[model samples]
Target: MAFPLKFTLVTALLLLAACRSDPIQFHTLTPAQVGDHSRTTVGVIQIESISVPPQVDRAQIVIRQGNSGLAILETEWWGATLVDELNSALADQLSNYPAQSGYSVRVDVQRFDSVPGQYALMDVKWRLRSAGESEPARVICRSTLQTPSGPSIDELVLAQQNNIKRLAALISQAAARKQAGCLMPVN
Candidate 1:
């Protein structure tokens, strides 16, 4: 009986320690707001590469009537916290372009149906990966620059800003491609 009890207690302690370990999470880079040729320009669209979750394990203990004890039980979890963090960072960075660039470039946060006369909802897909051996991560990011046939000047400005942001990020990634180590944009 004593042996079994001790085994259970030890198992519980180990499990607790594992649970208390700090969780790993990724961080995002700041967006660059600058002016260029009278048009608002984004110096860089810095995005971190998506990260994988750490492994987790749980321990369990079992006791036998014969006064023997056994500890056996481990589990793992696949969390998407990293993904959520990236998504939030991207959305936040994209949404702030208009104000940061003096509204010279527009940053639209609304959704609608069609493009121009046939207005439709816009779809966005963003992907990021390491470029060979570069210092910056390369990203394949896209967004539908949509508006009514005659979008207001503000709307058009926002669209251009959005495109510029995407372009800056992509160009940075491309230049950074061919090396691995650096994961964020420089300058």
Candidate 2:
């Protein structure tokens, strides 16, 4: 009877251990803390739309392997939808620019991928239109931002955030040029 009880207890413990899983972590692309606080405020900018690739539209972090494969990290997740996070970050980055009227920005992300120990890349086509404008100015931006990473996902996220910030800066510059009547034709 004693032996049977001990065996049952051991089996229960093993089962419990096998069923346990590591807690999942959620992350977001937030704006960088460092900024020019003294910069003048820009008029409100609305993110009209943000579209991402279907492969990366899910909550999990998708990683591009080589030419032919991808990996979705099951334990890692975005704090919100990827589009929402990118839009929020872009808005935050552009808040400092001064503008008299609201502007609308649209972003279509073609590629967003992170490779561990390598780089994070974002290829995007974006449009900016001032209030009541008949046409929007468009540009395609490609960023390959690099960062050092160990076996952790945090570094990859940081790199991606940086790339988004860079894109926002480009948009802000383009908006300023447009306001100054020096807008360039999209290529």
Candidate 3:
């Protein structure tokens, strides 16, 4: 009886070890190194907020299908929370500008959808306010950056990185225009 109990305990331990999975690999998105060489000096642009939907705010990558179904990839995760990663990427992207001027930016991410082997889509509403301005300028930007995923999560992450780069470019352009007094007041 003692031998049987010991064997059962050893079997359970072996099964538990076998069922253990390798640690999940985490990934991060980085800002593009390219800068606007035309501008010698850029203003201080502060990121006020970066908000995402609850489904995508967590560390796990959320893949959505149509309107209802969604899958959270447990094996693949962001290096940090999605919002933090985005904030870091955006701040890094804007760091190329000179810090002479002052501007505040706020972003509301409506959709951050990724489809393996297909495309990555990002739709965002953003606001920019120059220092001392009473109201901010608002814009809606959307990008359906496409890349052959090769059925890999790395490719999906790459697509997301590209989309973020595009968004940063748009925001930079807007900031340049505002700095140059090219943009008229919406009101």
| Candidate 3 or 2, higher TM-score | 2
lDDT of 2 at 144: 39
| Candidate 2, backbone clash total | 1
Q: Which ten residues in a row have the lowest lDDT in candidate 1?
A: 55-64
Give the per-residue lDDT digits (tens) of candidate 2, residues 23-125: 8899899855675566555585667889999999988899988887999988999998898888888777777555556667878888887888787778777
Candidate 3 per-residue lDDT over residues 66-131, each given as its tens digit: 668899999899999999999987777676554445777788888888887677777777776665
Give each model a TM-score: 0.22, 0.82, 0.75
By TM-score, the better pick of 1 and 2 is 2
> How many clashing pairs per prediction, in order?
15, 1, 3
Sort by lDDT, top down from the best: 2, 3, 1
CA lDDT of every candidate: 0.34, 0.74, 0.72
Candidate 3 off by > 4 Å: 1-10, 31-44, 65-67, 97-100, 133-135, 138-148, 178-187
Runs in model 2 deviating more than 4 A are: 32-42, 133-151, 178-187
Compare candidates 1 and 3 on lDDT and give the better one. Answer: 3
lDDT of 2: 0.74
Tens digits of per-residue lDDT for model 1, 1-187: 9999999999999999888854432222223456442433353233443332221111111111122432221221112342443344444454444221111111222221212222222334444443224433234444443333333323322333343345344334443455422233222
